[model samples]
Target: MSLSNIANDPNKRMILFGGKGGVGKTSISSATAIYLAEQGDKVLIISTDPAHSLSDAFSQDLSGGEVIQIEGVDGDLCGLEISPEKGTEEVKHMLEEEGVSDELNQSLSMLGLDDLTSDLHQNTPPGMDEAVALSQVMQIARQGDYDRIILDTAPTGHTIRLLSLPEFLDSFLGRLLKMRVKLSNTLAFFKSMVGMEAEKDRSVEIMEKLKENILQIREDLQNHTETEFVVVSIPTLMSVYESERLLVALTEQNILVRNVVINQIMPRNESCPFCSARYHSQQEVLEYARQVFSDYVQTELPYLAEEVKGVEKLRKLASMIFSDA
Candidate 1:
């Protein structure tokens, strides 16, 4: 498919750009968001990477958890850089509201067990950022406020971990729920002997809600028509290898990959030995990519003299990527 096809596809509300670092994923994602916004659609481009480059790409100071509207765009274009630390804190607050922390502390105190409330406040579990980011995406998708949601994800490994989280969490939580059920039954048996009632199953409710959210995310991801994964890479052997791995992983998950963008292609210059050598090597890699990913749409972006920073440069980049050229 072409950029126009992606732009005009009604079902493509969630577009994700991911690949190895230094491959111009941020540039492409930002340009795509700008292209969509310029086409008269409201777009929200979010960076889930801990090391954010969206603000740098736009040449604007876009820090904090709030979304800031991009000035000068004819249509609505907003950007958000998610802070993983802040996201973990938000998750803590949500758990507090759900009474998870309170109930766990109370139950542990009664049983003379080690208190986990302090530990929970001290540290967020590993991969919490991906979990929280997924939740944020789900929230934005459900709101229907923006015409399109473009995600500039982290490097290949991190993005794959994020994509696989729903399934991992669903199964893990299922086991936890089962254990909680057994615990509840045991507690009820003891309470009955003393003619007292067991407490309500708040843990069960929380786990069930957690499971439900995971299922919702899984459904949205598996809806191939509505979600498109755009893999970005450079015209290099290593980049092509990583992109191929990403394609296989996404295919295994049954997620749809609409495009593979080969960025930073060196222009042919036979007079310059250095450029000529690089161009020839890049051609071989490109051919390999074309053969490997024959079923998917592929696009090449010429190497620019300067770095792609600021809205003007991004607009120019967008034109190149989206145009029929």
Candidate 2:
């Protein structure tokens, strides 16, 4: 499929740009959002990476949890830089609001669950940032406020973890819920034998709802018609290998990769020896990428002298990425 076709597709509601760091994922994601917005679609571009470059790419000072509209754009284009710290806090606040932590603590008090509950709130796991970010993404996607939601994700490893977190959480929660249900049943049986009434456990209901939300997000992610993954890489050996790994990981999770963008291609300027040598080296890597990702649509972005920032530079990048020529 052509770049224009992918960009203009009505069914493509979510677009994810991810690859190794320093491969221009942020710039490409920003440009794509601009392109889609300019086409009259309301677009919101968000950065899930803790080290946010979306603000830098757009030359705008965007804060966490707030969407800022880009100036000089004819269409509606908003940007957000998700602060992982803020996201973690928000997740905690949400659990508190839902009384999940409190309910679980009260229900499991017999088993010394206070420590576990404290650990949950105090000690976040290694991939908790990504988990929080994914939760935020799901929340935004469900809001239906924008025609297209563009995500500029973290580097390859984190992105893969983020993509797989829903399944992991779903399974983990299921097992926990089962255990809780069995324990509740046993307790209720003992209470009935003693001629006492047992109250319905609300923790199970909360777990069920959590599982439902996870399943819904997973479904949305796996919907090929509505979601698209774009892997960005430069013409280099390491980049090619990383991109291959990323694609394989996504494929394993049944996520459809719609495109592979090879950024920073050397121009065909053979006058200089260094440029000539770099071009040849890049061509070899490019050919390898073509063979490896032949099943997916591939596009290349030329190396520009100036760093791609601000509206004009991003517009030029968008044209290069989506242009038929």
Candidate 3:
């Protein structure tokens, strides 16, 4: 589908841009947010990467829970860099406030298989960051105030987890919740025989909230036709391979991928060895993308003089992306 087809309508809340690391997913996602905001929509640009670059893209310090508005954009352009560390902390705080002590909470969090899961995540693996970051996005969506929500996701592995979340957690949570209820009832019966009341099931409350969030997202994704998935990749072997895998995964989940953005294609100007080699490599990858993905592919951003970080540079980058050349 065309940009006009997607952007003209404001109801499309979840616009996702994802692909390999350093493939310009953030830049394109930021540009799309800026472009949409310029069109008079209230746009919230969110970075679902632990190592966020949205602040760098906007040339502003956008930390904390506040939404910093972009100056020049006609409509609302709020930028957020989600902190998953904050998310985990929030969950911990909620548990604590509900009378779960620091000691008990720590032991509870540490005693389960979740402790091993914590170790795996603490290693700073690629996809774990994305999974945690996706929760941050869901939190923003839950607020339900924005005209559009643009998700600038982490690399492919993380993004794969984020997209698969609906299917991945749905059945998993269902079975776990059932088992928890059964076990809780069994424990309650034992406690009654001993003349003691059973412990309240706060676990059920938490699961219900989580399930609510997941189901709401699933519904938003299913019905929100304006929600589009844009993939960004450079014309290189590794990026091509990663993008293809992501596409296949999204297809399997029945997610609609609207565009494949090829970032940093080598320009045909210079005859330098590096540029020439990159040009040839990009040409091969572009051919592969067209054959495999066809019309879903849209826009090729050329290599720039320096990495795009500041707002001025990002504006130039945006110009090129939205340009007809």
Candidate 4:
């Protein structure tokens, strides 16, 4: 359904923002987080973009590795910026500490190659940062402390790949881990007969742990009540088209998609012919988006005079979202 309808749904616990780059998804997500916090909910906002600007949005430095609180909200309003490189390193550290050799352990570096993992990670495709983001989201959900979780996701194409990762990884890793375990056992038996000990494969063990994490995220997505995907787009032909395809992809995955947020609409400026013409052009694209998406559409946010940054500005945006003014 439309963003307005979904936001009105009290049972929805997670709100995700995704769209083409520079469509104001981050601003909308920040506003939503602030609004939820004002409504007496503990809200945790996360950014999956490598070039994260949540700290800029909040006017505070929030690059700490964990969830950090935003000072002004009435309820819990924490922010996290996930670095896939960092997450990959974290996994590698675990593997090495567990005693895998440098030669064999280098495979752990695979996790750092997001571009290489794009095809596999498309449905939760492997090695991409989106997987790290999803896992982080799952961790927050499992903790069960926050009333709401808002994610300022990457562009639509990337976000879709991330969302699909859980299922794809679940099946892929499950079967692979089983095979690895069997192979390891067989190799150990052969080494015993030769009077030599077989060393453990730390890479395999790391994969197994990642497999478990994927399974849990898959479970969380399936539950539906706790997670929802929101697609944000600008009032432009290209953005709308991308979002249309993204929606179809999500439906195929059986993922529960809640709303289509149309952001950064040109405000009516009667005196400026350029502004008026652009507004009319946006209106046409907006109309097309509504017709194509039907009930799933919501109006875009008007361009503001000043950049939306800091808790005070975000609160104003939250006000605008809920109010006519």
- Consecutive 10-residue window with the lowest summed lDDT within model 1: 113-122
Higher TM-score: candidate 1 or 3?
1
Please give, for residues 1-325, the per-residue lDDT of candidate 4 as tens digits. Answer: 2245545666777777778888888888898888878777888898877776898888987786688988888777899887766775655556557643443323323334233223232322444467776787778777888888888887877867776766666666665556556556766787799998877566566667777787677667755776787787888899889988888887787767766777778888889999999989998998888788775645557778899998888888777676632
**Residue pairs of candidate 3 with colliding backbone atoms:** none
Measured by TM-score, the strongest candidate is 1
Over 4 Å off, model 1:
96-127, 194-196
For candidate 2, the per-residue lDDT at 187 reads: 74
Q: What is the lDDT of residue 168 in candidate 3?
A: 54
Model 3 worst lDDT run, 10 consecutive residues: 116-125
Q: Give lDDT: candidate 1, residue 59.
A: 88
Report the Cα lDDT for residue 78, model 3.
Answer: 92
Better of 1 and 4 by lDDT: 1
Model 1 residue 61 CA deviation (Å) reads 1.5
lDDT of candidate 3 over 1-325, digit per residue (tens): 3355456556678888888888888888887788777777878998856565887777788876567787766667899888866765565556446533333334335436344224322442333345556666766776887888898876778667666665555555565566565555766686799999865646557656755765666555556465667888788878888888988987776777777888888787555988777778778878887677685846777888788876667767777776742
lDDT of 1 by residue, 1-325 (tens): 3577798786799998999999999999999999999888889999987676888899887777689998766678999988766777777777777765455565555666433345445554445577678778879888999889999988898877767776666665665555456556767797899999866646557757766776787778888878988999898889999999999989888889979898999999999999999999999988898898788888889999999998889999999888872
Q: Predict model 2's lDDT versus the native.
A: 0.81
Candidate 4 overall lDDT versus native? 0.73
- The per-residue C-alpha lDDT of model 3 at residue 280 equals 82
Look at candidate 2 and give me any clashing residue pairs. Answer: none
In order, candidate lDDTs are 0.81, 0.81, 0.69, 0.73
Superposed Cα RMSD, model 1: 3.2
